[model samples]
Target chain A: MILRTLRLHRFKWLLLTGYLPLSLLAAALVGDPVRWEDVHWLDVFGEGGGALMVLTWSLLILGSRPAGTVSNLLFIGLSLILVTLWQDNLDEFWTIPDAQLWDTWLENIPMPVGMAVLTLGLVRWYEEQRVLMAQLSQRERFMREHRSIDPVTRLASADYLNQQLAIELRRARRECSPVSLMMLDLDGFDLINRRFGAHEGDRLLQAVTELLLLNLRDGDLLCRYAADRFAIMLPQTSEAMADLIASELTSAIRHFAYRSSKEGERVTVTASAGVALALSASPEELMQRANRALSEAKQTGSGCHAMAG
Target chain B: MQWRDDSLEATWRSPDTPHLPAHHHPALLIELAHARGIPEHRLLRHTGLFPEDMRRGEAMLSDRQYRRLIGNILEYDTGGELALVWGRQSLPGHYGPPSTQIHNAPNLAEALNCLHHWRHQLSPLLTPLWWHNRQWCYLLWTTAGAGRRGPFLVPAAMAAVYGLARHRLARSLDWHFLFAAPRPTSPQPYEVNLGPTVRFGAGVDMVVLPVEDLYEPWPGRSQTAFTAAAHEAERVPALNGAGPTLPEVVYQSLAAHPETPAGLDDTAGALGLSPSSLKRHLRDYDSRFQALYDEVRLHHSLYLHQVMGLSMEGIAERLSHGDRANFRRSFRRWTGLSPAQYQRLLPE
Candidate 1:
C-alpha cells in the first residue's frame, strides 16, 4: 500500500536518483581521491547518515501526499538539504584543490536556501492541516490520533468516541450542561452488501459518511460505532435537541440517492437513530441506552428516531 | 477390531479434521474480508491456500488452517463486525448435502437435528449440542477445536444457526443467547444479527430457544428433498474423528460427576484412558485437562446458583467443596470476581 502511494512520486524519485550519478561524476572529474589515512571515518559516517535520513524523510512525505504546490515545495526543500549533505559527505572521500572556492560556495549556499524553503513548506503544511482540521471537526475533537481513525469511512472509531465522551462528560459535569449521544444505523445495510457485493457497500458507506458529516453541527462528533451504525456525541444538547438533529440526519441519509461506483445504479438508503440524553451516567451506560433506543427505532421501521427516557 | 476403532474415531471430530469445505466456511471469511477491499491474497497469506483452490471446491481445510485464516481476517478487521456479518450471511450456506438437508427440514426441530447430526460437515469449527427443559431448549455451543479463536467463532456459529432457523421458519425466533465471553464494545451486531435477548459473561455459550418455537413448521418443508439430502449427508465421510472431541469427552466426565471434584487421573479413568495419554490428546486439541475441568465445574456451579437458586454454601456442598470460603476463592479465581460481584452482573 505504501509502495502504491510512492508510485505517484516517480518524477521526484527519478530526480533524486539522477542527482547521485551526476554528483559522483562531478566529484570524480574535479577532485582526486584522498589517502585512506586522511579520510575522517567519523565525519563520513555522520554526514552520510544525515543525508540518508533526510532522503528517507523526503521519500515518506512524497509517498504520503499527492502532487501539489505544498508537496512540490517540501520535495524541493528536502532535496536541497539532501544535496548539501551529500556534497559535504563527498568532501570526506575526495580532496578538491584549495583554489576551489566554488565547492565551499556549493555547500554553504544551498544549506541556507534549503532551510528557508523548508520553513516555507512548513508554513504551507500548517495551513493545509488547519483547513483539513476544520473539515474533520465533526469526526474528531480536541485532538487527532491517527490510530483511532477508522479505515473505511475515515471517521473516528467507537473507542475514540468513548474517550472523547468521557472528556465531554467531565466537562459537562463542571459546566452543569446537558450532553446527548445518538446512534444512527443504516437500515438493511447487510442486505445491500449481499445484493451488490461489499465493494459497493463500502463505497455507499463512504458516501453516507460524507452526507452525515455534512449535516452534523460543528461541535457535534460523529463516529462509526459498528458495521452500519454511527454514533454522534452532542455536547450542550438536550434530548429534544438531539431528537431534532437525529431526524435531520435520518432524512439526509434517506434522501442521499447514492450511486454505486461499479454500475452507477442508484441506491437509496435510510437510517434509524436512538438518541439518549446524558444524566449523570457513565459513557458505557449512555451508549447502551442509545443503542437500545436505536434498536427500538429500527424495529419500528427505517428512517425513524427514538429518544431514551 | 480395526473397523470398531475407526468407527470410534469417526464418532468424534478431533481438531485435525480436514473435513471443512474450503469454499464454504473459510471462503465466507475470505469473501467478507474481500468485500471490505482486503485482497484475497492477504486473507490467504501464510495459510497456504489460494482463491483458485477455494473456487475449484476441491480443497479442504483442517481446524489449524481454519484458525490461521480466521486470525488473518481478524488482523485486518478494524470494525470488528466481520464475525457478525459472516454469521448473518452464513446460514442456508452452500455446504452441499448438509445445507440441502437444512433448507428442506419440516420444522425447526428437524433442521436443528440435521445440523447436529452432520456437525462435522456443517460446523467443523464450533459444535452445537442441545437438550431441553420444560420451558426452553438449551443449545450449547462448544468449540470443536477453535482454541484461542473460540470466542470469535462461537458468535458466528450461533448467528449462522439463528439465521438458518429464522430463514426456514419465516419468522424471527425468540432465542435467548448466553455467551461465555464478556459483553463486547458494541451490542449492535448482536442485536441486529442475534436479536436483543443476548446475555454475555455467562458460564457457557448457549442459545435458549423457547420450546414453543422449536417445533414451529418451516415454510419450505419438502419431505422428499429432506430424506435425499440426509441420505447424501450419511454417505459423506468423516473429516477427521467424528464423535465428541477430546475436550467434549473431558467436559462430559467432569460435568456428569460434578460432586467428586474429579482430578485429571479420575476423569481420565472414566474416559478409559490413562492420565498422560489423556493429557497428550487434550494438548493435540489445544486444550488442557484443567481448563476443561474448570469450564465444566463453572457451568454446573452457575446453573445451580442461578437456575436452582442455590446459595453459596449449598452450591459449594453440591460441588463437593469442603468449605464455603474455598468455593468463594475458587469461584473468584475462575471468573475474576467474587460470587456476589459476579452475580450482580446476572439479570434478575
Candidate 2:
C-alpha cells in the first residue's frame, strides 16, 4: 500500500534524488573537501541516524498513502527536513566558505517552512482518518453478529463467548493491557430445579443473568457458559479490579428477588463467582482458571474467588 | 433539574470537518449569508470550504464545518438570527430529492412520510424523529453534527418546516416550537423564526403541529406527477449505512403492531420473499431473524416507554412479557434504567 501511494509522487522522488547530488556537488566545489584522516566519523553517524529516520518515515508514508494533496504536502515537508539534516551532515565532511553564505541558504531556510507544510498535511490527514473511521465503524462494529444465541438464557452461547474472548484478548494484547473474566454459577441451582420446578428454576437463572448484565459496564461481554452458569469478559481490567466487580455482581444477584415465571412467587437467587485475570494466557486457559475458582467457591461455599494468573 | 440534550456528544464527529450533507445548497447558503451582508469569501475562507468543492452539486458537510461558517456569520449583528433567514429562503428549492418527493405526496402527511422514507437520500446525517397522535405531530431533528451544533439546527429546521408548510402546501396550521437549551436573553430570534408561540427550556427540541392540518392537499396537486416523483425518490441510494434491509423493515413493522406481529413466514410473505429465502437474505445482510425480532422488541420497549410515555405495564404488555417485573429487569439490563426512570431522563 505504501509503495503504491509513493509511486504517485515519482517526480518528487526524482527531484529529491537530483537535489541531493546537486547539494553534494555544491559542497565538493565550494571549498576544500576534508581529508580522510580529518573526517569525524562520529558526526556522520549522529546526523545520519536522524536523517535516516526522517527519510524512512517519508518513504513509509508515500508507500502507504494514495496520491493525494495531503501526501504531497507531507512529502515536500519531509524532503525539506531531510535536506536540512543532510546539509548539517555535509558541513562535517567539507568546508564551506563564509563569504558565500551557501550553508545558511541550504540549511536554515527550509527547516521551518518544511515543518509548516508537514503540520498542514497532518491536520488534513487527521480529518481524512476521522471520516474513514466513521465509515469503517459501520462495517466493523457488526463483525461479531452474535449468531450463536442460547435459546433459554437469551444471551450469546459459550462458543460465541470464546470467539469474543479471543477478539478481546487480541485487542488487549495489542494495547498491552490486562483483560479480566468473570464466571458466575448459581448457588444450589439443582436444588432450585428440584424444589421450585424446573420452569421456575429457568426463570430464576434468567433473572440472575439480567441482574449481572445490569451491573456490567459498557463494552463488557456476557455469555451463557453452561446450563446455570454465565461468563463475562471485562476488557482493560486487572485481577483485583475484576474481583471487586465480581463481588458487586454476587451482591446484586444476592439481593435480587427473582420472581417465578409460572406463578407469581418471589424466588431468592444467590450466585458464587470466580474472577480470573489474563496474563500470557489463552482464552481457554483463562476460562479454565475461572471455572476452577468457581468450583472452589462452590466447594467452600464462599461468595467469590479471585484468580490472578 | 431540567432535562438536557447535551448528552448528545459531538466528540465522534470531526471538528472543522468538510463534506456537508447534500441538503444544504452551498451556493444558496453562501449567497444567503452574502445577502445578509457577510462577504461570500469570508464565509468560505478558513473553513477549508470552497465554491468549487460543491460544484459537482452533491457536496456533504459535517455539522462542525457548517457550525464554523454559521458562527462566523453570527459574529455580525444578525449573528444567531441566520437560522431563520436560511430556512425561510432556502427551503424546497435548495433541497434536492426530498423537496421533489414532497410534491409527489398527496397531502402533508404523505409528504412527511416520503421525507422520512427517503430521508437518507436527502442527507446521511440529517435524521428526524417523528411522533404523532390524532391531535398533534411532534418532530425532533438531529444532524450528524456534534451536540453543540444542535441549537443552531433546531431553529433552522423548524423554520424550514414552517416555510414548507406555508409556501409548498399553502396551509398555515397552529405550530409551536420547543428548544431543549435554555432561553436566550434576546428572544427575538425565536420570535422571528417561530412567531410568538415558541417555548424554550422545555427539555425537548421539537416542532409541534395540529394533526388535522397535515392532511391538507398541496396548492396544486397532480396524481401523475406525484407518482413519478415518489418513484424517482425510491431509486436514490441511501447513504445512511447500507440502507434499511428487509430484516430492519420487519423490525420496524413489529414495533408498530404492538403485539406478536407475525412469524418469519408471514413477514417473508409481506415482503414478497419465501420464508427460507428470507432467512438467506437475512444471512446475506448479516442479520439473524430472531435477533432482529428481539432487537426491535427491545428498541420499541424503549420507544414506547420513553418517546410515547407509555406506562411500564403498557410497554411490558406490548412486548408480550409474561411479567412486567421481568420486563423491567431486562430494561435495566439494556439501559440501566427502570422503565419509568428512563422515560423521565429520555431526551425529548
Writing each residue's lDDT as its tens digit, candidate 2 over B1-348 gives 011122222122222234345335445557655654567677876666667666766566654455566666656544345666556444454354556666556776776666566543332234455666656666655322223445555577677667667665543345877665666654544553454467665545667787776777777767776677666645755333434324335555554453565778887786677999878765543356775565445545545654576878888776756588878786665444466654554323
Error of 1 at B281 (Å): 3.8
lDDT of candidate 1 at residue A165, scale 0 to 100: 90
User: By TM-score, how accurate is candidate 1?
Assistant: 0.85
* Candidate 2: residue A42 lDDT (0-100): 93
Count clashing pairs, candidate 1.
6
B-chain TM-score for every candidate: 0.82, 0.61
lDDT (Cα, tens digit) per residue for candidate 2, span A1-309? 456666788998899889989988988888678888998889899887778899899988888888889888899999989999999889888888888786877779889999999999999999998787454331222244535555456676666667777888898888889888877877656456545544565567667766776787767877766556788888899767887888888888878877776676776777888878774578878887787677667666646555544
Candidate 2 scores a chain A TM-score of 0.52
Query: Which residue runs does candidate 2 get wrong by more than 4 Å?
Result: A1-309, B1-24, B52-79, B94-96, B121-124, B142-146, B233-348
On DockQ, the candidate that comes out on top is 1
Error of 1 at A30 (Å): 3.2
